[model samples]
Each structure stands twice: as C-alpha cells, then as structure tokens.
Target: MTAALNIYDPSAKPTAGPRSLAGLTRPQMLEAMKSAGVEDRKAKMRAEQVWRWVHHHGVTDFEAMTNIAKDQRGSLAKAFTLARPEIVERLVSVDGTRKYLIRLAPGVECETVYIPDVGKSGALCVSSQVGCTLNCTFCHTGTQKLVRNLTAQEIAAQVIIARDDLEEWPTSAENRKITNIVFMGMGEPLYNLDAVSDSIDIMSDGDGMAIGRRRMTVSTSGVVPKIQELGTRTRAMLAISLHATNDDLRDVLVPLNKKYPIAELMDAIRAYPGLNNSNRVTFEYVMLKGVNDSPAEARALVQLLKGVPSKINLIPFNPWPGSPYECSDWETIETFAEIVNRAGYASPIRTPRGRDIFAACGQLKSESERLRASARKG
Candidate 1:
C-alpha cells in the first residue's frame, strides 16, 4: 500500500488561537458572540454585523468592520478570526482556469480550481480533505492515501480565498464570477459529511455568500448510506462518479462499488429527497478507452437510470502522469453519447479544460506532494 504523504498532524494546533468566523452559520455566529461576552439581546445583531463584514464584504480583519464600535470590534478580534487558508501557489491556465494550492495548517495542502465560462460566470471546485481515501485507479488524487477531513472553516475558506482572488466581493446576485461550487475536487466530500454540510450552509446563507443551493453540487463515488442523508440535510445538487454501468466493471473502476453495488446506489438515488425533473441527479461518466465507453454500456446506462430524473455527463478521461487509462476517442465517445441521447437523457460530452495546468476534471492533486516526489528523485 502506498503511504499517505503530507498528511495533517491532528495533534498540532490548527491556528495560533482565535476561533474562525469564516465557516460559522448564523446561529453559530450568534452563539459565538454570546460566548464572547455580547449580551443576549445584542448577540444576534452583533453576529449579523460581523457576518456581513466577513462574508458580504470579505473583510479579513475585524477592525475593517467600520460600523461596529471600536471596543466591540477589538473584543470580537480578540475572540475570533476571519483568516482564510494561505495560498501556497496560484497557477492560471492559459484558457483562464485558475488553480490554487491552498495550505490548511502546516503540512496540509489541497487544490481548488476555478474554471471560467462565458459571461461573468464560473465554477469553483473545492476540496473536502487534505488527501483522498478512495483509490480510484484513474484519479490523480487517488494516488495519495487518506490523510484527514478538512474542518468546516477550511472547507469554506476555499470559497473565500477564491473570491478574494477573483475580487468578487459585496455578494452580488448579478455579474457573479464564481456562480457555482462543486464538491468535486481533491477528496470524497460525503466522507466528511458534517463539515461539508456546514460549509454549504455557510456558503448558501442569503445574508452572506448568497450562493443558491441549486447552483452547488456534491459529487460522491457511491457512498450509498450517505446519499439519502446528503439530499435530506444539504438539499444541494447531486452527482455520481459512475464511470461504469455494470457492478462487475464498476467494482474495478470505482473500488467503493465493491461495498455498495450499482443496484444499491441506484436505489439510494431513487430515494433522494426532492429528486425530480427540475432537480435532476447527474451521473458523471468518464470515457476510458476500451473500458466503460462502449455503445452497449451507454444502453445499459440509460436502462439503469430509467425513471430517475437525470443527465449523463460524458467526460473524456483527463490524463495524468502514471495514469493507466486513456481517454476514449472522440468518435467512440460520440457514439456512446448518441445511444444515451436517443434514450432521452441529456448526455453532453464535457469539453476538457485547464489541461495545460493540470486543473481539469480528475486532475487535482496537491503540488506539495508532487514537489516532494520530484525532490526525492533528484
């Protein structure tokens, strides 16, 4: 077994002292204010004021909250912080995709990617863990062993850091650059359920980040038991990393399928709360050449997803160094998508982006590890 590198030391202190206000929800913020000596009647008001400053205005320092009284601001600053993860490296792809290597405590790093689309819109892919536990053969992150789950603060910090980079402040409904958030980066989000949900709650809070739940997507690699819970708790968009149609093939493609097969996964999806035509589940199918991208597999996929409000995203396998799989040819992917489209599913072949900077789908792995490996080799 490959040993996990750059794992977070749980015993180490996360930060110097003060609690982070970045990921706290409204109620949590109010409670925090109360604990910090704010009166019961004034706690809610003070929390709201701090929330607007930290999230709405993207102010890092409590002193920047100009409306708050000087003494109150000093007390709040002494009690809590709004510090985000330090950006160790920021790489901008030639095609306008920006990948940030964010450092969460010492020796803990994860990557967040921002893919720019047409107009003032883009998607931010955030990581939920320092390293991934899932060893999906085709995934770059899977090469690293399980490290640790990110805290709610760390998870929400990705968005805050990205917003800082984009200069997307004042939390606008119009002219938004980071319009969508995908829990599809470094680690399996469902594995870190509570933190991920809390971070989502903080991000989707109307008076703060204001990102609608509909625009946020959580992708899981068939964690069946958590699927229903995720839908009920978060009510955000759902996507499955379902590269294979049959259990026999899926077990090999996604190791997690060995525990919860396709049938069980489908059953979980069917029972997902608020699942309907408008709120459709997405099935992410990475087209691996000569593996799970045949026309027959597409037919099986359509049959498997029958009666489930869904769309199939056919992704061309993004290559990484030492990866064993090859992307399916364009003609092969087209043929496979045609079968699904004919069966009434919207199977769009996802155009690969940020390939030059290794920021495309399935390409996020921390640069710290890569550099370490390079150093050892040298």
Candidate 2:
C-alpha cells in the first residue's frame, strides 16, 4: 500500500519555469489554450471546460478532465504543466492552524497559513512577497529583508496547495475548510498589488474556485497610493495594519506611517470605494506590553475612526526569539478592548492561533528551507 502523504516532507521540489497553468486567470487560461494550438473557435470553449477542472475541482492532471477528449488533453499536457510548488515543510499547530513553507523557485520562498474557526468557516493567510518591504517593528516577518514579490500564479498556488491538503475539491458552499482568504501573511500585500489583484480574480471567479471577493481581504501596512486603486480593481475587503492611533506612535510601530501618516492613511481609507456599515474596513491593532494598548489610546482609536465604519482587531503581540516586544498584559488588553467595545465598533481581542507553530499573526518567516539545507550539508 502507498504511504500516507507526508505533510512534513522536506524533499519537496518546485516544477521549474512558467509551464504550470494551474493558477492562471480565466483570460490567461484562454491564452495558454490558444498557445497550445487549440483552434480559435474551440479555444474559448476548451479553456472554460479545463478551467473548472483545474480550479473548481483542483485537478492537477489534464487526463482527469474526462469532460475533455483524450487527444486534446494530450496536446494540452505537452504545452503546459499544472504542478504545485515545493511544499518544503508543513507544520500543524495544536489549535488547528496549518503553516506551509512553499518554495516557488530556487532561492524564492514564502509561507502560507490556514487558520481554522475564523470568520464563517476558516481563513487562509497567503503571502504576497517573499519577505517584506514594510518593517513594522513588532512583526517577526519585518525582521527579514525583502526577497521579491510573488507572481500572480505563485500567490494563487498557495490557495491551491491548501485546498489540496484539505481535500476540499469540487468547490461547494457547505463543509468548506477555507471560506475566506486573507493577505496577512509574510509581506505587505499592497507592495505587490497587481499580482495580489490578479490572483484574487483567479480564486474568486464564480466559474472556478468561487470564493467571493468580499470574503477575500487584502491587509496592507498603509500603502496610501494603492488603497483606493486596490478597492477599485478587486473589490476585495481592505484591512489596514494600523497598530497605533497617532502618527508619532505609528511611525515607531509601523514605519510606513512616517511617509503616509495616520491622517493621510485614514483619508485613503475613508475614500475607499464602498465605505459603509455593511463593508467596514478592518483596523488591525497589535497590543504590545506598555506600548500602544492603553484605555486612552483605545478611546482615541474610536475618535480617529469616528465617521468611518470600522472593526478593530486587537491582536495580542505574538513574541518571537530575540524580538523586542512582549504581549500586553491580559487585563490591559481587555481594558483597552473594553473602551473600543463601548464605541459603536466591533473590537475582538484576536485569539492567537498557531503561536506554538509560529503561524500566528506577524509571526511567519520562511527560513525553514535554509534550515533544511544546513541539515542536508551536515
């Protein structure tokens, strides 16, 4: 009998080059099909048929598409591939959070996380860049220098990988493990907005993966220029990584605030295409020990978001090795949240998931592959 899939297998390797059609958008699929010598009239129809199999059902092999004829499948296979990246390691947290160290190319890696019991069902936090450009002081990922931006296909492949592991094939509304997608992983998503936007289109297409745009939230560390454009293009929910209330504190906590201060950031948020109670912008506030988590600060947060509909996610700082911060005292966090709760906003002290596995918020780093290389050399 075959051995069970080793979720933690370290020898996993990537399918090199741009041959994989698994993460292509609908239009991209059409282009690939035409390039594969699919006749002009038949290309559109064939692309649609194969799109369902690749995305809706998460089929890796063209042969599995029984709806398409054998001869065409052979042609398609010769033209392109549908291979997933190397899952260098998969770690599962006791709390049901799953972290994946995925290698997209040689020397290019990023982490994707699936947190269970979030939103309606669960959320997959996918990285947009290899490391990070925004060095938010409290975040562990911020400590790593930026490697590069992930391609549209590379970004979408994270979802594809999660779906494969979860065995959530043939997308359905019920019994779904990942009902939402959050761009709150290793990188500042806005830095790679174009790929982030295209990947959203691929995953959210009703004819394909079918997760709604509203359920896919892109969290940015306040990229003022792209905030409105991101809303206009993707219609995905906007989440600002606004850790502190004022410019001075925010500058220290989120250094990007120095370039685009709280006032400017808020202005961009307020002008976000569809601002209302129904579609409130999320403000992620990481509560650090004796740092930004004060009752007065919470009140100021309420005032800062006076007119705009907002949900403040008060995250208790998840510490990392040699990190410069500690989580706020439980009572201090509760007190801070209480002030925001008194306001007309939803302020939930985000329960730390995957802290034991280093999969919690702002804790993701993709050094596992390097560690594996060192062990191999030894």
Candidate 3:
C-alpha cells in the first residue's frame, strides 16, 4: 500500500521575521497583520494602506508608504521587507522578447521571459521550479537537475521584476502591454502549486496587478493528481503539455506519462473544475520532424481530445544543443494542422519567438548556475 501524501497547508500562519512583500497575497498580508496584533478596525486600515503601497504603488521601501503613520512604517520595515530578486543577467531578442536571469537570495535562481507581439497582449512566462524534475526528453530545461521549488516570493518577484523593467504600472491600463501570464518558462508548475497559486492570486487580485483569471495560464506536464485542486483554487486557464498522443510514445517523450499514463491523465483532465466551452483547456503539441508530425498522429490527437473543449497549439519543435529531434518540415506541419483544423479544433501553428537569443519556447536554461560553474573554474 502507498503511504499518505503530505501536502503543505497554505493557510497556516506565517512565522515572524523578514517576510518579503512579494510572497504575501492581499488576504495573507491581512492575516499576517492581524496575527501581529493588527486585528481592530484601525489595524485593518493600516493593513490596507500597506497593501496598497506595496502592490498598487509598487513601492520597494516600507518607508515610502506615506499613507501609513510614520511610526508604523518603521515597525513594518523592521518586521517585513519589500524585496525583489536581483537580475544577474538580462537579454533582449531582436524581436523584442526579453529574458532575465533573476537571483533569489543566495544559491537560488530562475528565468522569466517577456514576449512582445503585434497586439497589446504580451505574455510573461514565469518559472515554478528552480530546475525541472520531469526531465521531458525533448526539453532543454530538463537537462538540469532539480534545484528547488521557488518560494511564493520568488514566483511573485518574476512579475514584479518584469513590470519594473517594462515600466508598467497597474493604473496605466491603456498603454499596458503585458496582458497575459503563462507558467511555461522553466519547471513543472504543478510541482510548486502552493507558490504558483499564491503568486498568481497577487497577479489577478483586482486591487493590485488586476490581471483577469482567464488571462493567466498554468501549464503542467501530466501531473494528474494536482489538476483538480489547481482548477478549483486558481480557476485560471489550464494548459497541458501534451506533446505526444499514445502512452507507448508518450512514455518516452514525457516520462511522467509512464507513471500516470494517458488514460489516467485524461480522466483527471475531464474532471477538472470549471471545465466547459467557456473555460477551455489547451493541449500543447510540439511537432517533431518525422516522429509525431504525421497526419495520422494529428487525427489521433483529435480523437483523443474528443469530448474536451480544447485548442491544439501545434508547435514546431524548437531545437537546442544535443536535442535529438528536428522541427517538422513546413509542408508536414501544415498537413498536420489541416487534419486537426478539419476535425473542428483550432490548431494554430505557434510562431517561434526569441530563437536568436534562445529565449523561444523550450529553450530556457538557468544562467544562474552556468555563471556560477564558470566563476568557480576561474
């Protein structure tokens, strides 16, 4: 018999110390303040004031929170920190895609990406784990060993750090460019569900960044167990990293399929909370040269996703060093997309962005560890 799983309770009280503002949700902050004896109405007023300054105004210093009493600011600063992850390196692609290597405290790091397109809707890809544990065969991120799960502070900092570089204020909705957030950058988002949930809540809260729940997406590579809870808690759009069709091939492509299998994974996906035509799931299929790019495979994909309300994102394989797969020929990819389109599913062939700087899809590797390795040898 299998042992019971130990899931961390997110609602537990935070320990007293230097807590980062990036980590706390609006409610969590309120709770923290109350725990620290800010339970009365005046205390609640102080909590709201601090929340607005930290999130709405994007104040990096507690002292700059002018609305709060001067004495309270000093006390808050002594107890908490409005800290952001330091950018160790920032690279911008010719296509306006920007990738940042952010350092989280000592010996911790992650990458975040911003993709600029024709529309005002740009996507910010955020990382969940410091390194990936899934180790999907075709992904470059899977090459590195799993370091650790990013804290809620680390996860939230990715958004704050991006907004800082983009000069984005929550108030400026008219010229605001970043319209979407995707947990598609580095590790498996499901593995770090607590942090991902907490971070995204801050992103979607109306009083702060104000991104709609529908605009946020959490991508998982068949972490079946967490799918239902994720749908219930966040209710953001769900995206599954479903690169292959059959269990036999999927086991090799995405090794997690070996444990969960397609049948079990599909069962969980079908039962996902808030699933309907209005809130459809996305199936991301990366087309490899002659491997999974055949018209037959496309038909199989349509059949597999029969009852689900979904859009198949037909992605051409983005190659990296030592990658075994090559992108499918344009004609092959087109043929494959035609089969799915005819099957009444929207199969948009995703355009590869930031390939020049390797910031495109499936090409993110943490420069944090690479730089450290180089420094040690020197």
Each model's Cα RMSD:
3.6, 7.2, 2.9
lDDT of each residue in 25-134, candidate 2, tens digit only = 77778887887888999999999998888989899888999999899889888877889988998999999999999988788899999999998999999998887877
TM-score of each: 0.93, 0.93, 0.91
lDDT of 1 by residue, 278-377 (tens): 9999999999999998878888898899999999999999999999999999999999999999999999989898999999999988988888878999
Better of 1 and 3 by lDDT: 1
lDDT of each: 0.87, 0.86, 0.82
Q: Candidate 3 at 91: error in angstroms?
A: 0.7
lDDT-superior candidate, 2 or 3: 2
Candidate 1 Cα misplacement greater than 4 A, ranges = 1-15, 118-120
Error of 2 at 8 (Å): 30
TM-score rank, highest first? 1, 2, 3
Q: How many backbone clashes does candidate 1 have?
A: 0
